[model samples]
Target: MPIAFDTTGWQQHDRATWFNPGNGDQVTLSYFDLVPDLPASLDDLPKLRHDLAVVVGEVGCLIEAHVVRLGDVPALLQVVKVPLPNQPSGQVFLGSFTVPKADSSAVLKLQAAERGMTGMREAVLVAQLGFENWVMPHPYAPEVQGRLPFHAGDDPRFDPQFADHPLSRLRAWAHHVVRTARVDPRFAALPPFRPATQPPAAQPPAAQAPAAQAPAPQAAADTGAADTSADVTGPTSPADFTAPPTPTPPADFTPPGESPAAPEPEPAAPEPSNPAAPPGPAVGSTLTTVVPGLPIGGYLPLWVGEQCTFWRMSDPEAVLDKLGLGALARTPLTDRRFRDLVALDASSATITLLDRYRAEDGSTGGSVVRLTRVSGQEAHQALTTDTLLDAFRRLGRISLAAAERGEHVTLEPGTHNGDLAEPYVLLAVEEHEGRPVATARTAPPPPPDTPMWQGTAAVTAPATRESVEAGGLLAMYAMNTWGEHPLRLCLTFGPR
Candidate 1:
């Protein structure tokens, strides 16, 4: 007998991977099972009802798993009218799992078991009900059902060839039913469903109007109030506020037993000196070249302030590299008239190389090398007075020893000139009384049109043995190159 249930609200609830026996690929089935809370009367009817829904699709992806009532009637009204035996709701499992493509029977059995159906009979009933009244029912022709091979014994089994048989194909087809239903307008207007897992929205407290306040009581007037103006007089004139005059002391009056203080002594006049010249280098100050033969040619003082020392170097690459500028030496010199400016910020030991270009207007432009702190410190320490002097002395000894060998002392090209030079001249200024007086050699002006090296010259005569015996040793140096090159390397030490 055909089931008497209505198919109105019966939604398709087939697993996404339902198998097609004919092609051996998973297929989409279309049919809805009765929802859990649907009228129990329809549960046993063996047919879809107008109001029934099922949790369809994969378990995690289940959709439309809601409890709906028949027609527009309230659930309570339907329950009161319909006689449905109270029975535990039947489970209608929905979802697909992996299966061998070659076997059609196994696929069907697995699908049925997943749907909570028992035995072959229950599975067959579900397939039939899902196919009935579907808009696009599987196995369109009724004759296809007869072609499917079915085992006759109580135990449902099929031959290996059964997959190719018409009955097997129809069974697979029956499981795939596509049905479309009109969505009720009322459902669209309903509020969206919020899952129970989420906490309820907090409601804002209602705004309350402020209570009206009563007017304050009025103060009673006093019958007799005093008039404060009667006690106050008119403002006084400025002349009436004069202070008493200070008393004057007699000419000969002095404090008892204290003799008159002696008049302050006048300050002595300073002794006269030559006004034509500026006060010469603090009398006892001495100027000495710490590292002589410091080739200053092709170099310009870019900056020389208390905290900053900058020099533009135009020396050969080999020379600059030796002077703690190996990195700058490696960089290609693109400009025709470019010089590397070595800048030292006293606070930081890093020596920054600024590639300066001499423009046609004699102005300069350049970029500074970005050096790390460690590299800067290393470079700065390499150029310290102590380090350079040590290297200078060692090189000088080597040159003198070679000369003593009776061989021509040909200094190596690109070698520092100070390496083969004489010992640097050290000068000491004699101290007059407690103050030390400074003495410096003034280089005579170079011949006209000649580029004169403007720097302090060393004293021609070394200090006498008596001067050496003097307490103060004003300066020390490793070598001197006063008149050798067309440049003078002058080092001014002391408080300056």
Candidate 2:
């Protein structure tokens, strides 16, 4: 609505008003009239990339980002990739340019899904570059793991050879459009967006200095409020862990293959305290503030039903959502089969229970449903068996052969690992209408080397709607190891 460009050589679709090239590639032009804090200039692209990183962290990786111009107007361009679910070799690529003014912005996007192996070009390119293998280490910081490295077709190093690749095509088109595009006069005349700056807090008189001031800095450090730079590992302390924020286009979009300049480092934060207490959001309270961190699971709102209840934010809900309760919200929890059905592995008399809703209904939109163990003494009492808790418990045990295969196996509550460290259980809930409702709880940090997205490491803090809206929730993804594809699920919450 805010910009115009040629639509040559393209068709149209219901949702894609721009154009399609007959192939799977699509181009769309749209605008958000009011996107708070969207910068009007490209100077902020470096800072904005960190914010954009949070959104793209889940399900994809940013291949290239740049600050450029469109018809004399500053703009941002970006290229990203999202791996297709259940298709290890398939990928969805997006190339876009974002132009922002004041509190609004316009976006021009080109998207294409490639179903073939993504790195074929890399094999040849690697040999030409004198590399032994094409699988190079990712260029991001060490904390940013699990994301696949830049594929050859998307990687700029091979752009000369892969000129017909989606990313390359998009770049050529973006440059042409930027040179000829026209913006609505009214939109261009709007006041430019300015970043908000916080004033220093007023200090109390020396005669009345607060006695507890010493702990304030420690608290800030523990919550990871001291550093917003990229180098800070996600969730330095448990208090900072949160659900992944919803993905959104940032104010600036750059060309594929161009990396944003790293921002100046912030002062180092003080070391966080290693508290043995569990880490999670405060549930059932009206408190709006929570520490921001990576998303370990999906977000769910509190629910209250005649037969069941739910807490505002909890990792357990995310766990259940991944196991299929999320899609079955319309189904009555009172169903007996959902409450008590169990499968026995006769080979070892082991027990297993699949997410019957997913099994019987074939819904959930391809979300990976793996049996997540709800360990700890409190898990049993917090979750009611009549509400499908037991069914989820045995689902993990159905794969005892995984342990024999040397895969990491889910352990039951009260069980110890080879190192004898008890798995900390982070769960809590309340009961209403005689139905059990679980809430969030705290737990000690997982082992330093416990990779994210693996078993228990995937369970961090619960996210709430308010947290996401306030920019306290970061969208971070870990691989979903329990499935053939690397898929992650986002839990949602709402009142029924």
Candidate 3:
């Protein structure tokens, strides 16, 4: 007998989902952990480990019986497994339950029994990860009549519901969807909806237009003026407010292509913003100077057309808790409204958040973010390492997730964790002495000769900055790390 979640015993099955991309089948168990009912203490550690192995093994459920040290600590362990499937096999991928930080099958099943939806978190779009996406404790809903679970919806890209439906209509209604003919019966239909946390279904695409949209559409719009004629009872039309006058098309409306006179000459663009802007070097300012091998700050006014940036603050909440500056953090970001580039900076030592404003100004004044900078007189402080590492992890998880899905990636300083697509195929914060130590980063790897994919940088949100005299060295460290990658192939310092 074999453990239920353990892939070792199942007959290897070829899958159409896993073979589509050039990158062939490979198993990856993102999460495998025990949910101890007993206290995890040093005195009871050995007994806990043995009991886990015995009970799990008796049911053919243990992946491997092993214990790992947490630096000098002894209670924690990172188990090992002989591959069978990357994820536990089941009817449909119930993304909600099968992910990192969550407990193993026994734990999930217990929790699911207690809660109708499994109450599992961290579910993601494993589109590129394959049928491993479907691995679970049982083949989908264990109580269902069919073996597989049913999600409710069609692939919007291949279907028109996501596009043709009005924003108001889509949000108010649900998609009509059914299971694949081969799908198991117990599973009900799947919903075409994404996690409630993702950008709303009707979100307009980035680059849809420059920021500052003509305000969002309003409900109960103003109706056109009524006729006030024999059958009418409402106010007269605004057009009728004045006489029903018909203005001439133009003083000189000409027939098609009759050689209309040319318009007068147009004015030239204004001179460059900074007259003394750096010269000789092709890059902008020392801060704005972006060498192919340099960090983002090497360039100024981070652009949207090509270049990008990311940054963050120390503990943004600490400031709010101490000084009551929560309102400052809540202020919305505007400059990067077009959603092209992400800006990370600290308003003060206390609070930090990402600002999604326009990259370029569509009207007078700077980008919307400039107006919405996160600052309060009471919250003066610098950015910190948490902010920088957060930015890095965000880029790794999400920016790459898009790359994995062949979708676009957004690199912003303030984006949340678990929001990324999957640029970072693997990222873990190395722990020591039962505590998180340093972070480890790994990617699918770019081909040799083009190290462009590898970027390591340290950004000091304004909170990270102590003074102009110090000159945001923490940020410089991140930029330099990102720009300066070893020419050597295959990682020398990854996954440790």
Candidate 4:
């Protein structure tokens, strides 16, 4: 009788989900191990090898395997496939080996020799052997369904009503697994699960005009009784032309003392107080208050618009732990808002939170925050060369080098004039172990060169931190084959 092979146990151990073959009373394989010695009665080595290979294939690490004769001994050869550079139609060998029948442990002992191999090999082997029984899948795994009761409002898993549900116990198990699992180095090299794109620049709200001030009271000017002394001048005919003698003041009229009655000094008008600062929303918008234990009092600002201020947590990990924002950190900034707060541009404003004003209950004491735009110099001063270099390094997915010293590649020109649209250049070149394997470039292409001409190209200064922070490089490329081929390309280095 042939031995029946079942991989349900392996699947459950490695993936944490039992495979339902929809059969009743099927005996499931509980464990698989590379026995040190082959059974003397086991005559069909080829059949056993084939069965094991099939199991491995189900987990997607299958490359190729076959039994071959090594001298007088039977040996099994296995090849594990890996990603290659540059050519989508190509693949390079990541791991390849032969396991002799006399040495059953040889395959299990294999280790990767290169940077990319370490992670790839470990991932593959783990899938084949499965983790320990205690190991569980990621907490957020969608496959683990119905952990919570359907009708339990407010997540009854935490309440006494659903204390016995499987979900109630999942949290502690997840924490243990997450804390104890061996971290894969390849994860560090991987790009962010979702990258952030430049958000649309925010338009400033229109400013409101100041309220109208009451008009000041004016004093009446004193004029001597409207020239009563002057003779009423009617239309005087030339015949009546008699020059009126100048009226002399009465001899008895003494000059009034106090210099002819000095005009009463008009009460000095009160100067208006400096206009109150214009009322409007302050500059940088706060996303959420920093979790307790953080040094900063303000909230993390969203990455909105061109300028905004965000709290720089001294201990980000601690804050993230308290707020459960680790998963959110992996997502694109534009996809989620922190505490439902929108981001304000840092360049335009500063945000400060009044944490000391918390209410008696410890909730926010009604927002005592200030957001105000900064001066132009203050807004732009932070984007120094070092700042940009740090940002580029933090991106991890891309790299920047001096254009003059960087490697260049020539591509066949396409059929559109580069002038009409922005010149398209390779934004990034994916590499594996420092070797270029793929290329990602801007869309649209320039017109193809004439039969006799190649293409024109040029490169600007290397991308600075300022440029990248400003959203994208402003470099241009033009291709001409006539005299000298000018290949203007912006090279971005990325992971393979």
Relative to the unseen true structure, what is the Cα RMSD of model 3?
29.2
Those runs of model 1 whose alpha carbons end farther than 4 Å from true positions after fitting are 1-357, 361-370, 374-387, 390-496
Q: What is the TM-score of each candidate against the true structure?
A: 0.14, 0.39, 0.18, 0.23
Candidate 4 least-lDDT 10 residues: 250-259
| lDDT leaderboard ranking | 2, 4, 1, 3
Model 4, 78-103: lDDT tens digits are: 33322223321112222222222211
lDDT of each prediction vs. the true structure?
A: 0.23, 0.37, 0.21, 0.25
C-alpha lDDT (0 to 100) for residue 434 of candidate 4: 57
Winner by TM-score between candidate 4 and candidate 3: 4
Residue-wise C-alpha lDDT for candidate 2, range 1-496, written one tens digit per residue: 4445555566544322434555557665554544434322356565566545544545466676677765445667877776555542345677777766555566667776653334334323432432213233334422343344433335565565777666666667777766666544445445544545523334333232224321111111112233312211122222232222112222123322222333445579999897443322233323221111111223221111221111112234333433322222222222211111222222231222234355455653322112223322323244332222133222222122222222222221211112212332222223446643222211333433323212233232112111111111001111112221101111222222
For 438-477, candidate 3 gives per-residue lDDT tens digits of 2222332333322222232211111100111111121222
Candidates sorted on TM-score, descending: 2, 4, 3, 1
Candidate 4, position 158, lDDT: 36
Using TM-score as the yardstick, the better of models 1 and 2 is: 2
Q: Pick the candidate with the highest lDDT.
A: 2
| lDDT computed for candidate 2 | 0.37
For all predictions, the C-alpha RMSD in Å is: 46.8, 24.3, 29.2, 43.5
